[model samples]
Target: MSDKSAALFALTNSLQPVKRVWRQAATQIFANSGISMSLANLVVIVNRNAQGINQRDLAEEIGMNPGAMVRILDQGTEAEYLERRELSRDRRFKTICILPAGKKLADEIESSANKLRVQLMEDVSVEDIENATRVLRLLEARASNFLQEHIHEKK
Candidate 1:
């Protein structure tokens, strides 16, 4: 590989371990706190969509299959944390809304995440964090764009 390609390859390869490390750490943290990672992420996303988000949109936002999203919502519904409501005139569509219990849980998740963020970046310089974040976002956007442009084309 050329120097440029080699650097890109190395950087992308290095991110896999970083992703695994973070996932492992997060799984442990969620376990210790008596929470499931999937549930936490799902609830947080629903909470963020304060106005209300329908099932299909919520599924897409979480990159979850609509069927799987229904299962997750079933759990939430059983817990009385969140509920699906008929937010539109169409009886076929329902929007996910955070109940009081769900909001409380979301708040706890956010608190835990904030604590984790503090510990994770305790000694990192602000400028360094900004630079790293910018680079990662750029790389992500570029990769997504490349896939969008090529994935639909006939090889």
Candidate 2:
């Protein structure tokens, strides 16, 4: 195989083991939470905002369909984790904000995630982590460009 293909093969092989390890740890940590992993992620997103954010903006940020966003919002509302308030300027736009309970849940989730990170990087040096983070950011930029180039725009 060419050098480029060989490098890609090695990189891909390395990712499989790392992915399995991290995902297994995450599954174990979240298994007893009574909430799906996806919902946990949504809770984090909702809690990231200071003044809350409009549902459409949230949907665009996550690339989710409007219907899917609405369903998640409804679920969050029913769970008393989020409150939707109408914007005064545009009453049609509803902003979703995390409740105090949701904020508390987010803190717990963050702690869990931090613990997992520490456990995963137990043997890795701090310098190595910094370097890896830089590389990951670069990879993210390249991947975004690649996807944009290959995927056709919606009409």
Candidate 3:
């Protein structure tokens, strides 16, 4: 393989362990905090869109199926964490609103996540993190643009 190909291969191989460790740590933290990763994510998203977010939009944003989103929302509602309200003008559409309980849970989850993040990054230098974040953001943007262009070309 060429030097570029070899380097890329090594980078790709290295990413798996990093991703696995990060995910495992996050999962453990969430479990200990009495919430699943998906639920934590839902709480955070709902809390961020404080006014009210459409059910469909929320599902799409989280890359969840509409049915699954409904089930999750149902669970949250039952837990008194969220409320599904039908729009006054359009009964067909429902909005998901985070209740006070949900907000509190989201804050707790955020705090736990932040603590875990700090612990995980204890050995990493701030400069190294900044550079890595910059490179990752650039790669993400380029990859997104490439995908968009490719999709348009297919049309």
Cα error, candidate 2, residue 132 (Å):
2.0
Task: Give lDDT per model, in order.
Answer: 0.83, 0.81, 0.85
lDDT by residue for model 1 (20-128), tens = 7876766665686565677777788889889778989988887789997787788888887788999658979999989888998888877877788789989999899
Q: What are the clash counts of all predictions, listed in order? A: 0, 0, 0
The number of the candidate with the highest lDDT is: 3
Provide TM-scores for the models: 0.84, 0.78, 0.80
lDDT of 3 by residue, 46-153 (tens): 998989899999998888998987778877898888899999999999999999999998888778878998987899999999998887778779888999999999
Residue pairs with colliding backbones in model 2 are none
For residue 49, model 1's alpha carbon misses the true position, in angstroms, by 1.5
Name the lDDT of candidate 3: 0.85
Which has the better lDDT: candidate 2, or candidate 3? 3
Alpha-carbon RMSD to native, per candidate: 2.3, 3.0, 2.5
Residue 110, candidate 1: how far off, in angstroms? 0.8
